[model samples]
Target: MKFTKLTSSVLAGATLLSIMAPTASFAATSKAGSADAKTNDNGGTKLPQNDHTEVGISFGDNNSNGNTGYLRLQAVPHTLDFGNHKLLDDSKLDFTADGKNTSLSVNNTKGSFNGTNANQTTTLATGTDTALDTVKGTAWATVVDKQVTRIDPMNGPEDTSDPTNPKPTSGFHKGTDSVAGTWTLSVQATSPLTAVDNGDPSKEIVDENGAKEEIKDAKLTFSDTQYAQTQNVLGLTKDKNDNTYAKDLADLTKQPTVAPVKEITKNVSTPLVANGSDITVAKAAAGEGQGANVFGWLPENIKLTMPAGAAVSNAIYKANLTWTLNSTVA
Candidate 1:
């Protein structure tokens, strides 16, 4: 059960235009599963589609001298539309990920293990286990509304027709379809390494009552050159009916591109705030920084897959994506 609401605001924020529309609450959106890649009866995709935008982000500082200065640029919508897309699951994505992050600090210059003071004191960082760390999150996507309309490649450019109106039982037919892509992603702690901040790390973890606890700038690291997962898609139908009432009206209305496809991948390197919402962009804007961000000019990992169908069809089937990250999330 899907719904469609065409709003002017959503069109303004293409990141690729920056528009504003209050955030939509995710009261009960289903979590991503194997359905992350699926098709529908009409060949339409199920994935949410939208544009992107860039906004100033403040992720604290990186220097140890209390001169913090690390920025973050939020990507609006975080979704894409294939116009007329399809997702053939059961196909595998050659996905892979690898990255490292640090979050430990010390301050025991007065002379303690590592560093455990409140001032900018120099102290040795002792070795600690990296398994004591962990992070939890998910990553999945899907497409919806495969074919918008079946076209009859026989009309001229000047043909007069109200595309959005009720149509007649004419023999000729032609139209556009909607292909979409969407995902639900998350990240979690999964490391045995502790930020042996030997120093007093409590200041970084502010308490609800303004009190502070020591949480070293330690980090959790992981490296998986491959994040491959197979998708089992459904919703493709076989609706090839000819009602042209003629000896051979096959030329009257051309058939739509009902090609059955599989495998599509998007390589993305996104940093998830340990306990922050992965917000979506509502629109895009035209500006110097509209397309680029602090992370880089584009998504750290953004690649879409093009699956191969029948074996005798000679189409190839393969997905290869890699990503990495280095950030702080408490």
Candidate 2:
């Protein structure tokens, strides 16, 4: 019985050893690296990056809305006043206005460097001052004396005649181009000016001598005149001054004073301020730097054309002007 018991115990012990050996082997492999072990990694790798952008532009009354550029325009004296004056017979008076006396200024900081357009222009128009007695025509007229000539300040003597020699107005019209473009300044009168006594064209007026007399048919005119700044590129040649003073005022009769006189045309007369004529006042080309005092004036002149026997009146006569500024890229 004892021998059988011993044999049974030995076989059981051997079976237990076999199970323990397998467990120990698994524990050792999990805790340490094996030279025979091979790693197969199947995966993807990534890298990073950045981006880009830009903006746009425009011009006008409102310029603060995120645009890339802008332009601004203004008239110095909002109102231009030609004070009261007494009209005399036979004797002619020289009446003119320009940047020195009457001025229009332009201020531009435009950053639109896209085109070759570096040009700007200013113009004028006139209207009847009163609505009381409607006159048949404009109260004022401009005429450049045909026989006169513009005297260059840098060259010589000023013409001493009425509607004196055309010259640059004192320090009035001036401009500077930060961008690239040309600027043209122009003017016109578009008012129907009429003379009347208590609004009646046939009323009589008391003269300085206290004589009540009929007002003669007066002539008002704008002399067709043009003047230009001397341009001397490369100091190559003599600077040519504007010779408009030497030219004749377009015959008011030939060039009807009822239409705008913009450009000089053969029979197309530049009418009174009532007619919208694009009169050239000043100009600045690209690269001309800042132009100062480029000037032109529409001198209004009145003449008693009717014979000495017209009836006159004792009343205040007035006229109004509508000056316009037109701009374009050249």
Q: What is the per-residue lDDT of model 2 for residues 189-260, given as tens digits with 9 covering 90 to 100?
A: 454333436545245345689664323332233343332221111011111221221132232223212212
Q: Cα deviation in Å at residue 297, candidate 1?
A: 24
Please state the error at residue 33 of candidate 1 in Å.
54
Residue 293, model 1, lDDT: 20
Query: How does candidate 2 fare on TM-score?
Result: 0.27
User: Per-residue CA lDDT of candidate 1, range 211-309, in tens?
Assistant: 433222222112221121111111111012212212122342453232221221122232222332222211111111111121111111222222234
Prediction-by-prediction clash tally: 104, 63
* Model 1 stretches astray by more than 4 angstroms: 1-139, 149-206, 210-255, 258-267, 274-330
Question: lDDT of candidate 2 vs native?
Answer: 0.29
State the local distance difference test value for candidate 1: 0.22
Count of clashes in candidate 2 = 63
